[model samples]
Target: MEWFKVVAFVVCVLPTAHCASDAIVWCYHLPSCNDKTWPTISPQYCNGSRQSPINIVSASATPNNNLTKFTFVKYDDTSAMTSIENTGDTVKVTFKSGVKISGGDLSEQYDSLQFHLHWGNGSSVPGSEHTVDGKRYPMELHIVNSKSSYNGNTSLAVKDSTGLAALGFFIEVREAAHEMI
Candidate 1:
């Protein structure tokens, strides 16, 4: 099995009450709230150095022997995925608990929370949030997981640096096999 090539990007939007992100609505696609002003959408996350690593230079990646195979629990259960919606910026999928993931050098198992797809809002735009060799993929998928130790309490998970994981997968169109020959 192909191990998770990219594991974990800290998520920083949990609150003690009423859910963390319920209060603020971020306009991610607008020029007024682009990259430079993204932090304005959530200033609370900027005070620390522990949020998501927005991007990574693949060429600079270091090989780790430890990030081995991962065991997926209940990934096939369609019921695990509870909801899906368009948040204006991206399409997000919510999970119904029980699905979990382990191995991949993790000291403990992580609960599979949800996943979202990153694709162009329009046919003319590039969709993927990440790039390979300076080119963006047609689409991308981010699977968010939180350490089970937190007991589904996102408020607690957001504080720990290693409490959350964001697995990313780039979707690409395959070339015709006969054409290759």
Candidate 2:
């Protein structure tokens, strides 16, 4: 069987988490810090408001007609990505200063921070983090942003519930074939 690529520009806006980390050792696959031990390993994230893997009840959703197109600042310059690093989890890219986003139902303009890609080895059932109809893509990109009001102060930004925004993009790798007749 050949690989099927996923290509979708899914923009879901919601109150999400902050990009704050500490000395506490936690991970996605490690036995000590996996889901089974998350409560004991990171009690703060296991609390009432931070629970993940939530089910979205589309039946109860209300359309927001006020959502306007996003305004991107300094993105056309092509120098937005300042640097890149591999954090053992994924490939991270730090966006250049001044690149920002506004409108699109966002309360305030969000300054571009960094983005990363999460991928899984070619697996049959489980492939990527973003899924549709139980089908997973090959890779997912997360563009992290903080409210411009924070002024690059990560510590302060992490305090507010709506301080951060993550733009998720799903990418799929397709297999092309050429054969001799």
Candidate 2 ranges beyond 4 A from true positions: 1-20, 30-37, 50-62, 124-127, 130-134, 175-181
lDDT of 2: 0.67
Q: Estimate each model's TM-score.
A: 0.72, 0.74
Tens digit of per-residue lDDT, candidate 1, span 103-173? 77666899989898777644555566656556666667888888999999966776665677667777765
Maximum-lDDT candidate: 2
- How does candidate 1 score on lDDT? 0.65
- Every candidate's lDDT: 0.65, 0.67
lDDT of 1 at 80: 79
Q: Which consecutive 10 residues in model 2 have the weakest lDDT in total?
A: 12-21
How many pairs collide in each candidate, listed in order? 3, 2
